[model samples]
Target chain A: MTATLPGIADIHHAATRLSGLIVETPLIESQELNKRFGGRILFKPETLQRTGSFKFRGAYNKLSSLTEEERSRGVVAFSSGNHAQGVAASAAMFGVKAIIAMPADAPAMKIANVRKMGAEVVHFDRVREDRMTVVRPYVEQGMVLVPPYDDPSIIAGQGTIGLELVRQAKALGASLDAVVIPCGGGGLSSGISIAVKDASPGTAVWGVEPEHFDDTRRSLAKGARVTNEPGHQSICDALLVAEPGAITFEINRKNLSGVVAVSDQATRQAMRDAMANLKLVVEPGGSVALAALSSGEIELAGKCVAVVLSGGNVDFGTYAEIMAAA
Target chain B: MTATLPGIADIHHAATRLSGLIVETPLIESQELNKRFGGRILFKPETLQRTGSFKFRGAYNKLSSLTEEERSRGVVAFSSGNHAQGVAASAAMFGVKAIIAMPADAPAMKIANVRKMGAEVVHFDRVREDRMTVVRPYVEQGMVLVPPYDDPSIIAGQGTIGLELVRQAKALGASLDAVVIPCGGGGLSSGISIAVKDASPGTAVWGVEPEHFDDTRRSLAKGARVTNEPGHQSICDALLVAEPGAITFEINRKNLSGVVAVSDQATRQAMRDAMANLKLVVEPGGSVALAALSSGEIELAGKCVAVVLSGGNVDFGTYAEIMAAA
Candidate 1:
């Protein structure tokens, strides 16, 4: 039996809920990219979003959906990356206590940003222990558990980007032939594909993943969910999810045109291009869509395309090195 | 005797000329500073402005004012900093070739950015010879010389920020007690002071300068233009203009309520506070307003103050080091 996934109605509600919680980041047309690619290219700069990532939409939507009693009790989550920042900032705004379980090896900058948002950060070894194991007790103790991706509200919230894309594209008097999205656990892509297909109808949606961690790409071909082997690796730390969520996978399989795989090197090049041409700081996972475009993994030589820059919360010292290499 | 500055009519024409050439940078409220000072603090974040500085507004205005014959020939300027970037980008937009002479000691990144904007760069030894000496031949050959400041159109274009300020403050339903602006050659402060005072009558305007490079302050006090000793000095590379321009000084002496000075140490602290609290990369010169706030030089404990974040175009390497030190 097919389970119901997030649809446009849910997405619309979540968008309304997340209205003030997230920034309606601009969808800017890149003159440089347009000149490089034959057709026009628009970039949705979510890097300027609250907490520097699109994850804030989902985080805030999930938190706002909670009952007052649950909110009063607090919230818990497992993330040391953009999701951590998202949850911390969202919880702070809601005046709720947040406990984030992060890998012990998380970057100091990430930890500091989380703490600055007033979240209590708990560290554990991701290689040795499961993060979910630590969060189960907190969930049992009445704290609402805001999962990073595997929830309807979260998916619906992320789908708001798709809504914005349609409106912005229409405003620009451009019909997008394709929309390329960076995928982690498929939450963002699933929601985006559903909404884009619903709103634009003719626009093709493509999800991109790093080749080293191509679980979603492989799973889509097999018509089922699949998990990566233990040794799978990628420099795109944020896209290192070993498997796609069941709900997200189902939605993506139905609405997405196809999944594209990009190399780590291509992602790096895309990140460099974003910094040089777009004057933006995009993280590895965030640049996966551009990686697909730049590396010719997704053809857009004669078609207008929208590439979502998912996040820009880069570590301080790493910015110069990235720009220098470019 | 008081000199008449550009009126609303002149500024309106400048704004009309510059509408599409420059970014309408956001006027965002500083939640942290507002809470700290017990008053509203709106920051015009020009760090995101094209070429990473407000210099572009003035530069573009100056270039746009050139006659068709002058535009067809080309333009020349001497700035190893934001003015160079601004002139380069603006000239390129106007389809005019730009020849820029810079000090040999200028940052590699700034030089590269100018080159990337299609401007021809000529380097000289500022210690032994002035940049104008190197650029004079180009100007003599009928190429229009674009001064970094000390031009009517440039001042009027920079004044657009003040127009925006009045509108933004009204939107917030708060009357700003004072607007503190950073002074380099006083182009920005001179332009803004006139516009702000005109648009929002009764609101006071203040100019800030680096302690070691208080040429504007000195000039105002002396009732005449003054110049500093030419040598290595202030950390604010952008604000080390030895003297206020003649035209700008006359405007400032009339419109400004007072001038305040901030130490190099205070500038560094403000830069740190900006990065840590606001997640922004502000150069020493860009941090002068915040420097005044943090050093208690503004006496704005319970008054609403508007501080302009004048620029954002610092080299990433410099940013990392400055952030580390702060």
Candidate 2:
């Protein structure tokens, strides 16, 4: 049986719960970007969030809601980097121990950052090992498992951003016609869609994915779950999910307008443009929504738009290569 | 005689004038940074400003206040990059033509950005030709000269940031103990100090500068105008002023608690730290105030402090070089 999904009411409760815990990241507008795109583009930069990503919102929401006994027992989770850091940082805040199973080939900076947040790391080979198997021992030891995108609490936590977006946009007297969000497991997109649709029913929600790993796009089109081909490679390490989460996919299917895919090259260009115009550091995954907009994949010439910059957890070597190519 | 220096009243008027024209750049707090520095550090990131710098505030304030006759004749100004873009963009908003005199050796990206804003550029040799000499023809033809930091209107415009800083901090329930601002000719520092001090009389306002070009520091100590030694060089190209501005110095001399100088190396490190932690692209000059705090030049162990990141208009080549060294 499928678990109960999060709704707008849950997101509002999460917002109240996370009032002082997480950063209310700014909704910034760039005049140069507006001039180039021919629309009023507002950027919800979660790159400036607590762990340099929006994953912190869900991680904190899930961990803080556990009972006293569960909190004392600690928690286990699997992620490449962003989710690992989010879980680790949230666990530390709640005075709970975190055991994170991460891919052995993950960016060194991300690995280092996760450890720096006081989490015990269990590395798994991405090609040879299943992350769930690697973390099964810890979960069996009475430690609760914290799923990255499948949990209702996690979805509700991420939905807080959607709520903030509506409030901030209204404060600026802007009525958005569409919102573009970067997608991995569809948790962020689904959560944001629920909140945005509830608050501004007239606004359309769009999800952007990396071209090579566009499982969500296929899933949405087919009206069912779809998996990506094995061994697909992309620079967007954060948005490399093989399939959308079961619970998140259900909500996204109902609320999302459509899903768009952007190429790696386009993502790189968006990163450069963000650095030059927005003065914000954006990782490949974080640049997908912007890439779609700048590459003309989504059309909103005269309308107001919002693009969510999901995260900024890139390494120096990767960042340098991107800047050099530009 | 120096023109009358702008006061709190003028800054309030400037805030009203610039209501929706300028970005209210986010005052962000990084939890990791707070942990490392052992204090609360709020960052006023003007790197996210309209022209990627806070210079836009003063430039817009000056241009929008010009008489109808003055607007018809257009405006002339000289700057390395940030101020040029600010002037060009602001003049364009008011439908006034702008002629900018820039150094021939300025960063190619900066020159290209200035041109992209539709301003007519006249190049001057920094060592041989005076900037004023290059723009004198335009000035003689009845075009108004928008001085970078010396005019009262310009100071009042920049002072609007100080007003925002006080309001944002109070909203967060944080009472700032000190505010460290980057200093060039003391326009930004003097303007912000007036607003900050008037609102929070107990807060200490400190000006930070490049180690070699510590003219403002020297001037503050001498109780009169003092010039830096000629031929001194630093990576902070935007802060190479030899002496403090005439009107700005009067406000700074009376309002600033003290001035501190940071090394080029420290500024570079701060830029790297900002990229890694804050996810903000900060230029060398913009990193000065942050440099002072990170390098222990400012004793802010237990205090709540605010550091203003003044600009982020660096070229890719220079930015890459700085990142590589880190």
Best of the candidates, DockQ: 2
A190-299 per-residue lDDT for model 2 (tens digits): 99999999999989999999987899899989999999989778889888887999999999898988999999999999999889889899889999999999766677
Off by over 4 Å in 2: A1-3, B1-3
Q: Which window of 10 residues has the lowest lDDT sum in candidate 2 chain B?
A: B1-10
Clashes of each: 0, 0
Estimate candidate 2's alpha-carbon lDDT, on a 0 to 1 scale.
0.90
Interface root-mean-square deviation for each candidate? Answer: 3.9, 1.0
Task: Give chain A TM for each model in order.
Answer: 0.96, 0.98
Most lDDT-accurate candidate: 2
Which ranges in model 1 have alpha carbons more than 4 Å from their true place?
A: A1-3, A28-41, A172-175, A232-235, A260-279, A300-304, A318-326, B1-4, B28-41, B169-178, B202-204, B259-284, B299-305, B323-326
TM-score of each: 0.89, 0.98
